[model samples]
Target: MSATVQTPTTRPQIPVTVLTGYLGAGKTTLLNRLLTEEHGKRYAVIVNEFGEIGIDNELVVDADEEVFEMNNGCICCTVRGDLIRIIGNLLKRKGTFDAILIETTGLADPAPVAQTFFVDEEVRAVAKLDSIVTVVDAKNVVARLNDSHEAAEQIAFADVILLNKADLVPAAELVALETRLRTINPTAIIHRTERCMISPTEILDRRAFDLDRILAIEPDFLGEDAHEHDDAVTSVALRETQPIDVNRFNQWIGTLLREKGLSILRSKGILDLKGSPNRFIFQGVHMLMEGDDGKPWGQDEARDSKLVFIGRDLDAVELKAGFAACVA
Candidate 1:
């Protein structure tokens, strides 16, 4: 009798949403609402203990960087040895939960947390990057944006940004703050709220990783191309109509990231490669980058590549020259 060989079952990708905000932006309050609210969804929250967040759920993990199997049948682990390990452990018990929400430290950059889903193969296969929801203190954003680049970065990387504490400021002030945020990241969906009052659907299950939607959402920075600066941190957009040599482009980007990753808060690009019929889309946080083939270039459409870099003190002349060298 011939032995039957069986293949491993592939689990459906669970969405992981990252929640970020400044220290006093009511992130904890919003998180508390998500946890204690009567919403039917179950969440495994990885929170910082120093923050005054109240997690009443049985799946609430400890603050330390260690792994533990909880009594509630949920896997609990701190974001140690990379989120890949903790997330991999969670996937092992995929039957216990519906989704995952990770709350980064206040004043922390969301890039590292966002990069985890892209950098790890195992985690990427079983989980989809839902969206990054950044909660901002509307009354304090002016001072915050000026005080720290971390504040600016949190705002820039957001898929959905919540202007919390909106009641504290006047309507005109609110409009002005919104305009400032839009200039930094015109693509993000902004919602004004009092005390972080936002619907769960607005943030959850957002297919942000879908490149086709991303292409439409990214703002047309090329037309005006007026450089906006938030202290040392700023955003740079690069566009070229020519197709690039794949190997040379990769080499340049790899080295660039290695040397300047610390300064680069976030990076994203859509490429037109010389030999490839399909478009190449890539984004990175610091030195870690992930890229894949996106949609095909139609015969009638113009073959143009666009790249955006959000960093501190990025040399446009040098970077643009490096990119131009890669033109096929």
Candidate 2:
């Protein structure tokens, strides 16, 4: 008789949802609902600040929360190490839980967390990115978007956006705010909810992540790791319709970051390069910057260049003048 070979069963990949938003944007409320709701699936939650008396821990049900400190107070720079370690350990207990949820600090940029799933081979084998869900404060999101780069990033990276506290704002204001959100991220699905009350079907197991869109937003999705942290960070936004001299902009930004990278936390831009059919996207964390060509410009689309810099004591005039000098 011939010997029979038995094949081992493959374990199903776990789904992970990254929860984020600006401070006081009802993230904790949403978290509480997710944990307490009778969704018939067990979830292991990872939080930035685990056991603080008055914060998320108190509101959540009794469960083990993994706490990790940001390296040099920068989530993008530091989370990779801790997240990989935590997730590696979680895989050992496979089949005990149905999914994983990560709630980031209000100031965090979700890009790094999302990058982890794609960067790590072990984690990638066991877990699949479900979506990035952002909770927004309907009354204050506009102001936050204007002043905070983190707030805008949370919105930009989200696959699902929760416009929380909808009762506090008028219908007209909500409409306008959502319109503004679309300009920043046209692909996300925005849901209006009060006190974060929503059906589980809307958030969990949706499998809404699109890697192609992420590459469009972050040109170097698989490239070098990024890091950041600072006090009194300010933002400068520049927009122009005319094509820019790529050589001039490259020289200027390279010199500027080399000289002043310490003060700058983050810089990002989408450019209409001279004589190019495709859009140019670039992202920088401190001194390290990367860029690549993005999707081709639509025939009817307005060809515009937009850039934003977030840092401490930014000289808006100098940055604007430098960008203006790059116009072709």
Candidate 3:
């Protein structure tokens, strides 16, 4: 006796959107809104921890970070392997969800997340990496961007950015902030909001990973240009508690840029100025740098400056000492 089996016919791949932002940048709030909103499309959300989802259903799964963590807070290493196992398992219950949403930890970099969908054999075969929707906190973004390189990387990789908590800042400041964000990531579409409110259509199914879309946004996102932090491209983070001398810091940065700008691809920081009540924030792309005064330090806020550098062959000791020289 002989038996014949038929393989399941392939269907249109499910769209996937990655939700990311700095801590307290309103991701969970936005996820809550997305779930509660009347979008009519069922969603599967994967997160690092389970909390405050409200809706009681199997749509949400807590992500077990079997993947390794990078210094900048990205979990892309083994995520494809994990997702392949999880999503493949989720497929057994096919027809239950129209799309999938992955909410990585606030400090995560979306590059690795996006890469998983493009390279994983089983994952890409069944699911498409739709877009990366990053949430930015209007009031606190300056500090967060200055302190976390992941924040900058998030903006760099986003197809859409929900600039939430817009009501907290003035229109002029918001405009200025948007301009700076654009300079850092020229490709992202920015949407201003209060309390994470926005239309679902704006972020979902953007096909950010499509070759045409990627070429339109930034051609380097897919090929050898994608930085894996190998020998040619590397990253480092520096932290200090002492307030920096604004003028001295500027001079030091200017000289560094003049000397090493080409090798320095991205630089970002939130500085504690010796005499200022407000935090001084700044970020740079190559030789271009911009900065502005940020929210005043709270009565009890900790005053620490964090700086991250991603570039080619950066001399950590020299750079660290030069930065330290700017301290008061």
Candidate 4:
């Protein structure tokens, strides 16, 4: 006669928040807010290597990445070996952090990252994907949606969306944008924020990842459907040693937007502008752009200009030529 062994009714599972947003959508701002808030919950953050110089990582708490395609060549049905290994190690000393946060690169489709939670038995046993929180640039999401599949997928996969930079847009536009978001992801909770200033409680520990609902929406959330990335969309990183001529840079950018704004999804740069001791940081989505003075150059800091562009059918040579022409 053998006595039945009772398995533990409940096991401790760490809550994870998968944070996503398109380029220049202020994901790092939201992430920084979450980390600095006195919410009494410590989080182990994992950020993707965002820029050529790790500028985004420099703004965040930590960083990491490694992606692979499954045997079936479906890009969406993929996994990150680094993610698994990191989480596995974290699980060993789980008490150190109360939760985990994964901030994906701007161009990333959250499907593969979210699938990691469902596909890995070891990770699944110890971690619960609490929710997918997407930070949207309220001022630019409309333009983004028209040209970016990743942007649309990010919205579709979100459990909560921060309609960030709401103050930048008019109220009527905000209402219309919210209505548009509802059409894409009616189930997600949308919160308006000027700078991702929301209670951590509202965004964290929600236990809001509804797999059944996601399946009903995506049917293939578990990756039965073969999907591939849009090879047409590409990123270009440019570096310039000489300080850029402000007038030349503006004229060139304006002309470029006029000629290729439809293909240009996003653009960002930290510039060493002629006659400015401070760093000029600028980011744009399609025809819209904004810029402001960043911190003054440190005594030992490099003053070289670094720019990145993500778009469809971008001409690297033409872009490089144009950037070179901006040198002061």
Local accuracy of candidate 3 as per-residue lDDT tens digits, 1-328: 6596545675778888889887788888888777777878899888876444454336877775445322312211323346667788877787899888888887775655665664566886888777779999999887876666777777766768999999999999998787666555544678999998887777787752321221233212223433332234455556677889889999998778657865676565677899999877765555545677876888987777766665657787888898889888
The sequence of per-residue lDDT tens digits that candidate 1 reaches over residues 57-158 is 766554433332222112121123446676777777757878888777787767656665665567789877778889999988888888877898898788
Off by over 4 Å in 1: 1-9, 32-41, 56-58, 65-85, 118-125, 209-230
Candidate lDDT (C-alpha), each: 0.74, 0.71, 0.70, 0.73
The residue pairs in collision within model 1 are none
Q: What's the CA error at residue 37 for candidate 3, in Å?
A: 1.8
lDDT of residue 265 for candidate 4: 59
* Cα lDDT over the full model 3: 0.70
Please provide TM-scores, in order, for all candidate models, with all chains considered together.
0.79, 0.58, 0.60, 0.58
Error of 1 at 29 (Å): 3.5
Top lDDT model = 1
**Backbone clashes (count) for model 3:** 1
Please provide, for model 2 over 142-238, each residue's C-alpha lDDT reduced to its tens digit, 9 standing for 90 to 100.
Answer: 7787687788778766778999999999999898777666545544678999999998778888753332333244212212212122224445567
Largest TM-score belongs to which candidate? 1
The positional error of residue 142 in candidate 2, measured at the CA in angstroms, is 1.2
User: Ten consecutive residues with minimal summed lDDT in candidate 2?
Assistant: 219-228
Worst 10 residues of 3 by lDDT: 69-78
Model 4, 26-56: lDDT tens digits are: 8888887888778887788888766322322
